[model samples]
Each structure stands twice: as C-alpha cells, then as structure tokens.
Target chain A: GQQVMQIPQYQHVQEGEDFTTYCNSSTTLSNIQWYKQRPGGHPVFLIQLVKSGEVKKQKRLTFQFGEAKKNSSLHITATQTTDVGTYFCVSSHQAGTALIFGKGTTLSVSS
Target chain B: GAGVSQSPSNKVTEKGKDVELRCDPISGHTALYWYRQSLGQGLEFLIYFQGNSAPDKSGLPSDRFSAERTGGSVSTLTIQRTQQEDSAVYLCASSPPANEQYFGPGTRLTVT
Candidate 1:
C-alpha cells in the first residue's frame, strides 16, 4: 500500500509571516494534488503537480514536485487570517482510484 | 448544475444503529469518491466508483462499511451496527475527465 506523510502537523504564525508544509510518499506517484479544508468545511482542490521537478505558483502560494515523484511541498508567502486551515497532499497511482492523503498540516494565522 | 452535493448534512444515531449517507456528484463526472474525516484529522479514503465497473473498495476499514453507486450518478455509504468510533464527517467528491476533484459539503455523523 502507498502512504503519504506530511511534516509539521501544526503551525501557528503571525499575519504576514510565511508557512510551508512538506509531503512524502512511500512509493512513486503518478501525480500529487494539494487541498485545503477550512474549519467545518470540505476539502477543496487547490492544485496538482505531475511532472518531476515541476513548480507552479498561484498568487502568494507556490507548489513544487520532487524529481523522484515521491515528494512535494506547498509554501505560502505573507499568510493572512484567511489562510488558516489544514492543507493536505494526495497522490494516486492507478488512474481513477482512491487517492491516498497525507495527515495534513494545520495552519493557524493570527493577527 | 454545479459541484457535488450531500444529504443529511448532520446525523446523530445511537450505538448499534445503522446509518446511510448520500452523495450526488456533479453532472457528467465519471469518478466519485467517499472519504471520512474525524475531528481534527485529515481525509480518510473509503471507496471509489468509476462508471458501472466494480468499485474499488480496498480503502474500507471494516466489513461494516459499504457503499454503492447507482447508475454511476449518486452514491450511498452505509454503516451497520455503528459504533462510537464511527462518528466523523463523511465527504463525497467527484472528478471530471481530469484528476482534480470537487468535494461536497459532507455529512457529519455522530454515533453515541
């Protein structure tokens, strides 16, 4: 079975600070996707990375995929209160199968 | 006409009772998934449905858990003799041709 592990289970940062979360998989993945779940909300798809050594940016957030296709990271710059939530990374091997999700990193942005 | 939708946004049942959760995926989506999220925890995969083919049930935690998709549209997750540990938010998501999934509001189940 494949397993995805995330680092820094929890993080608390002041507004305008930066934050990052790392994810590693036990086996190589075809692609990795990032999701955000707000308090009492469902997980929302954020982005996905497929190619090795790939990088994508969305506004103040940046995502990277490892060259080995077994790791990924999400970094947010100048975090705001709206950024508070749990960030999860999911990977799937066989197409259309259930995605294995990491434990996720909880971010708390304080004013 | 939009994203995924779930029924019974919240449910509270006694121990040993059975409960059913429903999920309605977006129109024309070919893939649907069921996931559970415990309090302060990440999403836990439960099952996946792709078209009329057999569903991938490998993620189910126990025999008491089961799910079915009717006509490749809506899905229902049933828990038999539910225990207190069964309390969690059941989330449903659907994907188009691509891998990016869109999630529903989820059904919050509380077994006491």
Candidate 2:
C-alpha cells in the first residue's frame, strides 16, 4: 500500500512569521494536490502539481514537487491570522484510484 | 452551478443501528468521492465512483460499510450495526476528471 507522510504534525506561529510543511510518499506519485481545511469546515482544494521538479505559487504561498516525484512542500511567507488551518497533501499513483492523503500539518497563526 | 450537497447534516444513532448518508454530486461531474474525518484528523478516503463503473470500496473499514451511486448523480453510503468508533464527519466531494474537487458541508454522525 502507498502512504503519504507529512512532517511537523502541528505548528504554532506568530503573525508575520513563515511556515512550511512537507509531504513524502512511499512510492513515486503521478500527481500531488494540496488542500486546506478550516475549523469545522470541509477541505478545499488549493493547488496541484503534475510534473516532477515543478513549482507553483499563489501570492505568498509556494508549492514544490520533488525531482523524484516522491515528495512535496508548501511554504507560506508572512503568515496571517487567516492562515490558521490544517494543510494536507494528497497523491495518486499509477492506478489513478482515490487520492491518498497525508496526515496533514495543522498550522496555528496567532495575531 | 451548485456544489456537492449532502443530506442529514447531523445524525445521532444508537449502537447496533443502521444509518444511511446521502450525497448529491454537482451536475456534469464525472467523479464522486466519500471520505471520513475524525475529530481534528485528516480526511480518510472511503469510496470513489467514476461514471457508471463499479465503485472503489477499498478504503471501507469493514463489511458493514457499503455505498452505491445511482445514475451517476446521487450516492448513498449505508452502515449497518454501527459502533461507537463509527462516529465521524462523512464528507462528499465531486470533481471533473483531471480537475479540482469541490466538497460538501459533510454529515456529522454520532453513535451513542
């Protein structure tokens, strides 16, 4: 079975600080997707990376896929209070079945 | 267009009882998924439906859990003889092939 593991299960930061979360998969992945889940809310898709060694950005957020396609990272610069939530990385293998999600990194930004 | 919608936003049932959760996917979407989220936990995949093909139920925890999609539009997940551990928020999401997914508010189930 394939599994995705995320680092820093929980994080707490003051406003204006930076935050980063990493996701690693046991096997190579065809694609990786990131999502955010607010408190008491459903998970929302953020971005997806399909190519190896790919990078994408959204404002202050940056996402990267490893050259081997076995890991990924999401980094936020100058975090704001609104950034508080859980960040998850999901990956799908060759079979194109359901996405396997990582344990997720819970970010807490304090004002 | 409307996003995924789920029925019985909240359900409280006794142990050993049966419960059914419903999910209505967005129109024209070809893929629908069911997931479970425990308190403060990540999403757990349960089943996936693509078009009219058979569903992928590998993520189901036990034989008591089963799901079906009718006409590729609506889906229902049934749990029989539920136990305390079955309490969780069941989420439904729909997506077009090779596109981002949209999620529903989810149904919170509590087994007492």
Q: Give each candidate's interface RMSD in Å.
A: 1.6, 1.7
What candidate 2 gets wrong by more than 4 Å, as runs, is: none
Q: Which of the numbered candidates is closest to the native, going by highest DockQ?
A: 1
lDDT of 2 by residue, B50-108 (tens): 88777878899999999999888999999999999999999999988756788999999
Kindly give the number of clashing pairs for every candidate: 0, 0
lDDT of 1 by residue, A18-65 (tens): 999999976788899999988878788999999999999999999999
| Model 2 agreement with the true structure over A1-111: per-residue lDDT tens digits | 366999999999999999999999878988999999999898899999999999999999999999999999999999999999999998888645777778899999888
| Structure candidate 1, residue pairs in collision | none
TM-score of each: 0.96, 0.97
Predicted candidate 1 versus true structure: per-residue lDDT over B82-112, tens digit per residue:
9999999999999874488999999999999
State the lDDT at A15 in candidate 2.
99
Worst 10 residues of 2 chain A by lDDT: A92-101
Cand 2, B chain, TM: 0.97
